[model samples]
Each structure stands twice: as structure tokens, then as C-alpha cells.
Target: MHLVIGGAYQGKLEYAKEKFNIKDEDVFTCTESGDLPQGSKCLYRLELFTLSCVRRGIDPCGAFSDIGAWSGCVIICEDIFCGVVPLDPLAREWREATGRLLNKLSPEACSVTRIFCGIPQKLK
Candidate 1:
């Protein structure tokens, strides 16, 4: 599995697409109301999926494990835990949840890349 992370609007999705050679049709945009298509080669906006799971009273990490197990899957998520701590309780919770999910995925991922200014830096 591959995990790509960076700040919002940092070109993580484009980097993942180029790096993985995934076509548009094979990419899954993970959103609150959307479901992951079975055997999707790529998943983007996973931070929202995690937040949605939190709001729905579900364990986001556990829910993600199944998707993460897919061979050759590429996951793209924003690195939202940086900078000042959020004042809102729900915002704080979402930040923590995103961090935990990233931690859980990093070790298992065959490759992890951090993108900044359209540049890719391999982390693992």
C-alpha cells in the first residue's frame, strides 16, 4: 500500500496520480456520503472520510483497516494536525483522529510520501 500526505492544496493527489500511474476512472474520492468502490486503486480526501466516521460514531481507524489491506492501494490524505491546536472540541477530535489514522497506516504502507509545493519527499 502507498500513503501520500501533505498540507491542503499541496498537490498530494497529482503527485499520487503521477507516481502511481492511476487513471482518473480508477481513483476514488472518499467523501462523507460516498463509499469506497471495491478494489479501488486510489483513494483521495481520506481525511474527510475519517472525520465523517468520527461524526457517525464509528471507529475510523478500524474502518480504514479493511481498505488499507488492499494490495497496491494508494491513499491520499491531508496532514491536518500541524500548527496550533484547534479550540473547538470537535475540531480537536478530528485532528487527533487524523493523526492516529496516519500513524496506523505509515508502518504498513510500502511507501509513504510527503508532498510540498508539488515536490515529493519519500518518508518510508
Candidate 2:
């Protein structure tokens, strides 16, 4: 499974659909009220609240990263949350989680993955 996570209106879902050719029916919007869709191997709009605690430096009891590890899913978390100040506890936690996930996935991949922080169009 390939996960693409982002805030509302960030185009993460759209990019996944377009870039990966995923159908609408294949997308599962994880929410407190909605049950996980049947046979939906892919999750689309995962509730931000599920991961919001990490932003506050409080880790969620069971996070998607844990699920991803078990399921061998590739997760792409984009602009999930950003901090105004450098060296913030929340920022450190986020970085640590990301690093752990990446290391778990492939520790030998030494190439740097550049993260562009700018207007989306600037990517082109």
C-alpha cells in the first residue's frame, strides 16, 4: 500500500489518484464516524486528528506508521504539520518518526530525498 498524507486542500489525494491511477472507489477516507471501506487496500483521507497529537509532542497510541510497518505500506506524509520555530519538541518528534520509518523501509538507500518547501508549481 502506498499512503499519501496531507492537510485539507493540499492536493495529496489528487496527486495520488492522478499519479498512481487509483480509482475513487479504492480510496478510503478514515474518520471517526465512518467505517473502513470493505476491500479498500488503500486509504485516502486519514483524519488529521489521528496524527494531530504528534504535533503537540504527544504520540498517538497506535499510529498509521505502525500499521504501515505491518502491512508493508509506503507512506507519503506531506505537510502533515509544520512548526513555526526550529528545534520545537513537536518538530523533533515528527522528524524522528519520519527518520524511523525511512530507516525501517530501506536503510541502505543513501541518496538524499530533497523536500521542496514552496508553491506546488515550483516543483516543476
Candidate 3:
């Protein structure tokens, strides 16, 4: 699995598409709803997945226990924990959840990249 992270509007998805050769059909946009699609090759907006998990009282890390199920997958997550801590309790929990999730994924990922101003910086 590969991990890509950056702030909003950082072009992480475009870079992932070029680097991973991911097609539109293979991409899944995560929102504050439903379960993660195990079949998708590229998972976009993974921060939202954490939010969904927090909202539904689910464990994001547990959902990804089977690393083998995500082999060759390209995962994109927004860097929302960089700024001031959110005042809202749920948002703060979401940020912490996403941070933990990324911490787990980064070391396991075959590659980790951070996009800034449309430029890709390899982090792993």
C-alpha cells in the first residue's frame, strides 16, 4: 500500500493518479457515511473516513486490520491536524483518529508522499 498526504487543494489526488496509474473507476471518495470500500484501488478523502468512524463510534484502525486486503492500494488523506486544535470535541477526536491512522499506515506503506503546491515530496 502507498500513502499520500497533504492539505486541502494540494493536488494529492492528481499526483496519486499519475504515480499509481489509478483510474477514476478505481477511486473511492470517502465521506461521512457508509463503510470503506475494500474493492477500491484508490481511496480519496480518507480524513472523511476518520470523521465517519468517529461519528459512528467505529475504530478506524481496526477496520484496516487486514493489511493484505489493501496491497497495492493508494490512500490519500488530508492533513487537518496541522493547524490549531479544533474547539469542537468531535472534530478534535477526528483529527486525533486521523493522526493515529496515518501513523499506522505510513510505516506499513511501501511509499509515503506529501504533496505541496502540486509538487510531490517522497517521505518514506
Candidate 4:
């Protein structure tokens, strides 16, 4: 599976559709709400839901695992940083969350990949 990610308005979804020759229905948009740009298959608003759960200290591992299982084409958009930050607490937490989710779904057959717009940063 391919994970296409970008900031808001970066055109990642459009790029994916064009590059892969996939129709709007073939792509799944996982955003804040069930609503998405017209002509998209927004199955689940995972970002908002996950943020809500995480903020409340609720375990979202199961949700991430489920998404991994069900999604063959995913687009993770908004809120992802693309710079070499001077490491801070919030960044650390984000890294931890990303790591935990990846670990939980590591064995899944899908090919996990990330697409970012702009100059790539070394995420050491």
C-alpha cells in the first residue's frame, strides 16, 4: 500500500491520482471529517478521530492497526511537519506516536510509504 501525505493544499492527492492513474473512488482520504473535496472516497476521518482519542489519553493503536488492514490506498494529510526541527517535547511526542503506530502494524503486508512535498528533511 502507498501512503501519500502532504500539508493542506499541497496537491498530494491530486498528484497520487494522476501518477497512479487512479480514479477518485480508488483513493481514500483520511482527514478530520467525513467531508472531503468533492469526488473523493473519504471512508474515515482518521486524523480528527485519532487526535481526539490521543488528546483524551485513549489508546488509538487499534484504530491505526485497523486502518492499516483496510486501506490499500491512503492519504495522510495536514499537520505533518517537514522540517528539521530543534527537537522539542511536542515533536518528541509526535515521533513517539508515529513510531508506536508503525510498530503495531509492522507485520502488515501493505508497503508503507510516505510522500512529502517541499525539501525533504532528515528525520533523525
Candidate 5:
């Protein structure tokens, strides 16, 4: 599996598409409907997915575990734990859970990259 992480608008999705040769149609963005695309090689905005899971009262870790089972999948999410901590409980929980999920998923990933200023730096 591959993990691409960065702050919002840092071009993580563009990096994944260029590097993986993934077409726009193949990329799946998490939504309130919770309709994840099965068999997709790339999944983006996992931070939003974490928030969606929290809003639905679902365990984000478990959700990530289930998604991570798809080997060779490219996961894109923002590093949400940085900057000012949210005053709202739900927002805080989402940030913390996203960090935890990334921690759990990164070790299992064959490659991990962090993007900044549209440049990707490999971490694993």
C-alpha cells in the first residue's frame, strides 16, 4: 500500500495520479453518503472520511483497518493533527483519530510520501 499525506491543497492527489497513473475516474473521495468505491486503487481525502465516520458514530480506526486491507491501494489524507487544536470535541476527535489511523496504516505501507509546495518527499 502507499500513503500520501500533506496539508490541504498541497497536491497529494495530483502526486498520486501522476505517480500511480490513476485516472480521475478511478479516484474516490469520501463523502457523507459513505459510498466508498470498491476495488478502487486510490482513495483520497481520508481526513474527511475520518470526520464522516465520527459524525456517523462509527469507529475510524476500524474503518481504516477495513480499508487498509486492500493491498497496494494509495491512500491520500491531510496531516490534520498539526496547527491549532480544535475547540470542538468532534473536530478534535477526528484529528486525533486521523493521526492514529495514519500511524497504524503507515507501517504496513510499502511506501509513504509527504507533500509540501507540490513536492513529494518519501518517508518510507
Candidate 6:
């Protein structure tokens, strides 16, 4: 999988689309339900998916145990763990879990890119 991470409004999805030649039909925008389209070429809003898993008391990593399924995918997640920490326990846990999930996937990713102000920086 290729990982694309950045803060909100950083153009991560746009960059992915340009780089991967992705089409609207090939992208799956995740929601607060832990629902992942295994066949989608681009998985966006992954942070929200983690929040859904946390709310459901489910291990998000378990859903991605099969690396082969994502081997050729582009995964985009927001960097929600930055700046001020949330006071709510649920928010904190969600942030931490998202960080852990990204860390776990980073090394395994075919490439890891971080977007900042519309600029893409390769990290892996």
C-alpha cells in the first residue's frame, strides 16, 4: 500500500489522484462505520474509520491484517494527532490509535508521502 498523510486541507487526496491516475469510481471515502471497500484503489478518510472502530470497541488493525489486499492501494489519513491534545478520553484514544495504525502501515507501505501546503514530501 502507498500511504498519504497530512493535515486537513493539505491536498492529500488531490495529490493521490494526480499521482495514481485515480478515478472517482476507484476511490472509497470511509465513514464512521469501519466499512472498507476491499476492492477500492484509494481509501480516503481512514482516520474516521479508526474512530468508528474505536467507538465500536474493535481493533482496526485486525481489519487490515491482509496486506495483500492493500498492496496496490493508496491510503490517505489525516494527521489528527498534531497540535493541542483533546481533553476527551475518546478523542485522545482515537488520536493515539490513528497514530499507531499509521506507524504500523508506514514501513509496510510501498511509499509514504506527507502533504503540506499542497506540496508532497516523500518519507518512505
The top-ranked prediction according to lDDT is: 3
The TM-score ranking, best first, is 3, 6, 5, 1, 4, 2
Worst 10 residues of 3 by lDDT: 31-40
| Error at 99, model 5, angstroms | 0.8
Off by over 4 Å in 4: 20-22, 25-46, 66-68, 77-95, 102-109, 116-124
Candidate 6 residue-wise lDDT, 1-124, digit = tens:
8999999999999999999999988899999985787767999999999999999988788778987888989999999976798989999889988888998899899999999999999998
Q: Between 1 and 2, whose TM-score is larger?
A: 1
Residue-wise C-alpha lDDT for candidate 3, range 1-124, written one tens digit per residue = 9999999999999999998899898999998887888867999999988999999999899878998898779999999977998999999999999999999899899999999999999999
RMSD of 4: 6.2
Index of the highest-TM-score prediction:
3
lDDT of 3: 0.92
Winner on TM-score (2 vs 6)? 6
Q: How many angstroms is residue 120 displaced in model 4 relative to the true structure, after the best TM-score fit? A: 11
Error of 1 at 82 (Å): 0.8
What lDDT does each candidate get? 0.85, 0.45, 0.92, 0.47, 0.85, 0.91
What local lDDT does model 1 show for residue 104? Answer: 86
Deviating ranges (above 4 Å) for candidate 6: none
Ranking by lDDT: 3, 6, 1, 5, 4, 2
Count clashing residue pairs per candidate. Answer: 0, 0, 0, 1, 0, 0
Q: lDDT tens digits, residues 1-124, model 4? A: 4444445565555655665577766655444223333333332223544454455565556555445444554434344444565377644555456446545544452443343564232221
Model 2 per-residue lDDT tens digits across residues 29-90: 65433333334545544443333545544443345434443253223444444545446765
Q: Of the pair 1 and 2, which is ahead by lDDT?
A: 1
Considering summed lDDT, which 10 consecutive residues are worst modelled in model 2? 110-119
Task: Write model 5 residue lDDT over 1-124, tens digit each, in one string.
Answer: 8999998899999999999999998888887548456567888988888888888888777755565466768989898877898999989888887888899888888999999999999999
